[model samples]
Target: MGLIRKTLGTALAVAAGGAGYLTATTNLTTPLSADDELWSSRSFKRFNRHRNPSIQDVCWKSIPLSDVRPELRENEEALTMEFCRGAWAGYAYAPQRAIMSITNKGPKTENQLFDEQQLASSKYELGTRFSDHFEVVERTRNSVTLRGGGSPLEPGPREVDGLFVISAKLNRQAGTVDVGLKTVFFNSAEPTGKKPAPFFVELLHRYYARAMVDDGARRLTRKTP
Candidate 1:
């Protein structure tokens, strides 16, 4: 009986150790702060955005925000043009996987379009057929906020409503920019009263978020000449 108990205890210890390692490596916890501005809006439903029936993924990076801020401020047209001109080629999930197009209904003159007020209302298409629409909702000398959402490229019976906010802060003195990207996906197919998405799906989202942040950081570093 003593030997049997020892064997069982060793097995339990190994299982616990493995579980701890998996948790550490996966980083499955949500990283959002309660004070983020995104949570302040009345339209921003916390339950719909972060809890059951929705999946939120966040990605962040600290790089040379100055390098990217210029393009972001240059105007919606210029930003879209740069993205299409291959500035973001290396950061895409797959080779030539994503494409963007802009529709500037605000102004015809380039100078006027660059004005922050005019740029806020511009619309963009992330894929061939309006996979996402983007707008510059807020901006300042040191920060910019873009809000966007649309259907997923993947087809399924489930209807998806996604809202994303990409907030960037530049610290020129430190030569670093901190970018926080938050995406919340709401699925209509989920039965009423159902729980959040399965663990594996959330895990994949976390990995994808990390990949996006890493890729953006790499691209920014490469452009910091």
Candidate 2:
């Protein structure tokens, strides 16, 4: 299995650097209009943007959790969700801050897409799996970013086809400053997976769904912001 592991590792160029490793994940936005397609019958066949989550908040805490790691391996008896950071072995060659166009091609789904081997190539395991039922359609771009927090701050938002930025907005309630974001993914990828790639895709789907919710919550919640 080491042969396959190393082969997969090299195929993805994960050994090229120290920060290239990272698990694959995904996200979204937009308020649906009454006549909007997201709420139309074509899309409603499977998805209901109507029931789509409300921002529930305007300004918030930490950035969304949509970028968390993707994996299922855990040390507990419970099959709970986890995004362990240390588990990411190498990430220098991994895909981060990626941007891609995904359209659901599934007979029963929409907005599903994948990019080449990102599902399992490199670091930042981010650490856990995305959502299940999520599938690939097309990749517009794939890029990554490494963030360094406050205090002299280290390197940050190193590269991108697209990137995230802090967004400011008016707070009617607080009459003070409010913050959020504008995250856009780069479009540089191919939808292909090898050997265990299918498994990776499945895991990606599951992880994405949860991450979207968590991320939105983090970004929209007044408590966290």
Candidate 3:
């Protein structure tokens, strides 16, 4: 089992630094749209237009309608909720809870940090807090945006603010539902032009973003018979 895991990880590293990685535990699919279209998406525009030194990334994976859980196949909103829930369970949040634990804080489970009922609902009010750091700043039928507060895993308002968005859209022509996970990080002050993040920081950021979208899509799909 250990040998198989290592070989698979090596294969994935070769396949998709620009492409993807896959395993029983994780899957990273190629982008669902062309580069031009993806970069021009509405969600992409939100950060690109306003923040000067901001780093923004959007990862997308398409799941065939037939592959999704039967109950959520036709419901974009529910699919979005499910994706949000699954993304929180990605590699990022485990350490988040652990760091908080050192201080005797944080929730025991991801569900407690991100309430199942709230995640499943379409009506998340602005300012709804999650964990000790994140809060819903925007929400719609098929999308929700969270803003981070001060925490060891997140920067405070004084330095930088973090935004994460999860969304699902039905692509009827393709007979698939596209799930998107986006993240933005930027200083809170006025525009200072484009300054890229440190190499390792950007690397880790992209990996985490992809893991989240992949994990979320996996949950929404059914195992093949």
State the displacement of the C-alpha of residue 74, model 1, in Å, after optimal TM-score superposition. Answer: 12
Regions of model 3 farther than 4 Å from truth:
1-50, 104-125, 149-156, 194-196, 222-225
* Superposed model 2: Cα runs more than 4 Å off: 1-40, 44-199, 223-225
Mind giving the per-residue lDDT tens digits that candidate 2 earns over 89-198? 11311233232223323333232222323333322222112222221111111212111111111112211122222222333354322233222222112221222123
Residue pairs clashing in model 1 are none
lDDT of 1 at 159: 40
Q: For residues 1-225, what per-residue lDDT tens digits would candidate 3 score against the true structure?
A: 999999999988886663444333333343233453435555445534554565666777888898899999888988887787767654545676456545534453343244333333324456565555676767788888877635424432324556677799989899999998776666553455654456578667777777777768877884422
Q: Rank the candidates by lDDT, best first.
A: 3, 1, 2
Pick by TM-score: 2 or 3, better one? 3
Tens-place lDDT digits, model 1, residues 42-148: 33452244433556656665555455645553343443332322212334344223332233222332222222222223332332222233334444343333333
Cα lDDT listed for each candidate: 0.44, 0.25, 0.64
Over all chains combined, what TM-score does candidate 3 have?
0.67
RMSD of each: 12.5, 19.1, 6.8
